[model samples]
Target: MRLLILGTGGMANQHAKHFAAIDGVTLVGGVDVDPKRVEAFNTAHNIPNAFPSLDAALAWGEFDAIANVTPDAIHHPTSMAAIAAGKHVFCEKPLATDYAKAMEMTEAAEKAGVVNMVNLTYRNVAQLQRARQIVQSGEIGKVKHVEASYLQSWLVSKAWGDWRTESQWLWRLSKKHGSNGTLGDIGIHILDFAVYGAGSDIDHVFCRLKTFDKAPGNKIGEYDLDANDSFAMTLELENGALGVVHATRWATGHFNELRLRVYGEKGGVEVQHRHDWSKLLVCSGEDAETGTWKEVAVEPVETNYQRFAKAVAQGKTMEPSFRHAANIQKVLDTAVVTEQDRHEHTV
Candidate 1:
């Protein structure tokens, strides 16, 4: 499978590295508004072609798929274009800025009969995959409760570099720069972590968002620093589980982490993805009677990059498909409204 990478930002490097490592895939080209970035990305990844726009690339039409690593706002137009042109897409998360646009992209991909997948990132965690399997196998009885969080200390530490001066990090703090704050940034991730680990979908939400003062007068030059720094959502899963999903850049001690705890009548399970490793734990059967949680070993699994390549090769869509992402976006969109109206919103 020949692949093109759209938006040669930081995330593009991961996409390029993983896809290029796949057995049957080749990194054909890259596109970015900044030609220098595109040139650098091509050189770093050893991609042969670089284009200023997807239109130019489409005209050339040499690659079979595109890795849509564009910003959240740009996802709709670029992905719609790719789908319209009959190219498979593996997009970065949030799918789009909102559900309506996400649904449009999802429908377009479905109609085009293309392999469409979103990089929910955490889906690559083997522990998450195994926890979902355990949930499905009914080892946990029925999931009755869940707690999920995505935490980062970038606002409190330089572990991710200074957001004070970096465009990549600053843009995420400014709504004018197309950031929905933490909710838009990693909301989908923790949401997917909880729902997928519990083997259910979100059915309702009551959300609250907070933007702490990060700068003098709340202005860091062009960056507004107004995009929410933190968000909390209380959710009702389709299978009747009640849960809370939250994320924040202000989490002081955490560099970056995603954790989920799922509880059922028979037992409970915990899945965690820290910076470099993942683990799954369970307290079920006889152990559940005594509140003893034991670690369950999980083998490494194929990443979303590999899965997208496989789906493209087989001409079949997989989990976290465009439709599934759109569904998650529906919950996120409602979270925004729920925050404003100060009430629960059904998804």
Candidate 2:
């Protein structure tokens, strides 16, 4: 299967690298707004074709699917266009900045009979799958509460080269570019992972989206930095389980840290993935608190690119399908609204 990558940034580059290892998948070309970035990506990744725009790549009609790796703002339009063009799509998370647009994209993809999946990257990890198995198998009994967090320090220091520049992180803080900020970015992952582990959907959310000005002198006169840099939420799951979810890009020492703990009436499990290690620890109710926590082995899971390739080849919709992602979008939508209401009431 031939694929066209729709961006030239970091995630796009990772997609290229991962797809290269898949047996039957080939990355035919790339499309980006910046010609130089496209050229650089092509040169670095050995992609043969680099189109300056999505239309040009779609017109070429040589690829069987699209890897939509564009920014949050562009996710909707690009994925919609690709599905309309009859190409299967593997889109990045947040599906869209707007929930309604995300629903439309999923519906359209289903109507087009295209295999669709979202890059909820943790879903690709074997440890998470093992965690889910523990919960579903009743080793943990009925989940009562869950605590999940995703943290990164990149936004705190603002020293990651061009990443801290106004055109980059500032644009992310802007309402136009990325309204949900850390919540939409990493927070969604926390939600997805927690729900996946509990084997349930989020029933509702009470959330607070907070912005800690990372600018020098803690002020940005130009952009309001309206998007959140951190968030905290209380969630209720469909199966009567309660949860606490938090996400922050300002975590001081943590870089790409994601942690989850699910507590059940009879047992509990904890999964942590960070720069140092990826571990899943479990304990049954019979195991005394003083007893050592058992470390469960994580089996190997296929990468998202490999799974997408196999799903396309087998004519099956991939797990974490567009429909599944839209449910997550709905959860985000509710959180956004609840945050706004809280602000309005405080004002």
Candidate 3:
């Protein structure tokens, strides 16, 4: 398979590495508005073609798939163009910033009969997969409650201002780019994992969002700063499962700390991120009468990207489809809507 990557950001570089290492795949080229980024990626990866714009890359027309790691705002348009050009797409999450655009892209892919995948990489984590297996095996019984949080200390310190001090990364703080900051960026991963492991759908949500520390002088280009630095929500799921999700960039001492705890009728499961490894801890009620907790063994599994590639090659469907991704997007949309409504009422 020939793959063309759009965007030379960190995520795009990661994708390039994965695709390059995998057999039966070739990294055709990459495109980025930043000439330096494009040149750097081409030089580092030994890619023969480096296009200044996505249009130029698209013009190549020799790729079987397009890996879109562009900003949240360009996800829809870029994916649509790739799908229109008869190429499969692997788009980075939250799919799209808005539900309508996401749905449109999904519909387009479906109508065109092309394979569309979203890079919700957390779903590929070994511990999370083990949790899913335990839940599926009735080891956890009926899932009742879940709590998930993805926290970072990036914006907690003034040093993070370096990225925002430039106009390059400023689009992240803009609402026009879609779904406001870290909520869409990292929160969606936890939300998707929660829904996936619990095997339930969210019905309604109550949310609270805030911008605790605003660095006014930190401007990234022409983008305006109208995004939240932190967002928290309580979700009510379809199966009477209650969930709490928190995502924040302003949390101190927590760098990429993602964790999830699920409680069920018969047992509970916990997954924590520690440095480069994820640890899974499972507990079950001892007996009907005693009602005591006991540790259960959970064997580790590898990541999920290889599974996606396998599924694509074998012509099979992955469990969390773009359809499933769309569900998460709806919950995210509703949470934002609810937060805004409450804010309006308070005003």
Candidate lDDT values, in order: 0.92, 0.85, 0.76
* Number of colliding residue pairs in model 2: 0
lDDT of 3 at 86: 78
TM-score winner between 2 and 3, please give it: 2
194-218: candidate 2 lDDT, tens digit per residue: 9998888888788898887666764
Candidate 1 runs further than 4 Å off = none
Assess candidate 1 and give its TM-score to the true structure: 0.98
Clash numbers, per candidate: 0, 0, 4
Q: For all the candidates, what are their Cα RMSDs to the real structure?
A: 0.9, 2.9, 3.5
The candidate 3 region of ten consecutive residues with least summed lDDT is: 288-297
Return the top candidate by TM-score: 1
Query: Which stretches in model 2 have alpha-carbon errors above 4 Å?
Result: 158-166, 216-222, 288-291, 343-347
lDDT of 1 by residue, 51-77 (tens): 999999999999999999998889999
Worst 10 residues of 1 by lDDT: 159-168
lDDT of 3 by residue, 1-347 (tens): 77888999878778888888877878889899999989999889888888887778778787787788998889989999988987878888878878898899989987887777788888767778778788778877887889988888766665445545655446667776454777777778878878776767787788888765465553445665677888888887787888898988777888678888888898888888745777777777565346554444555543445555665677554655667777778777777778877732110
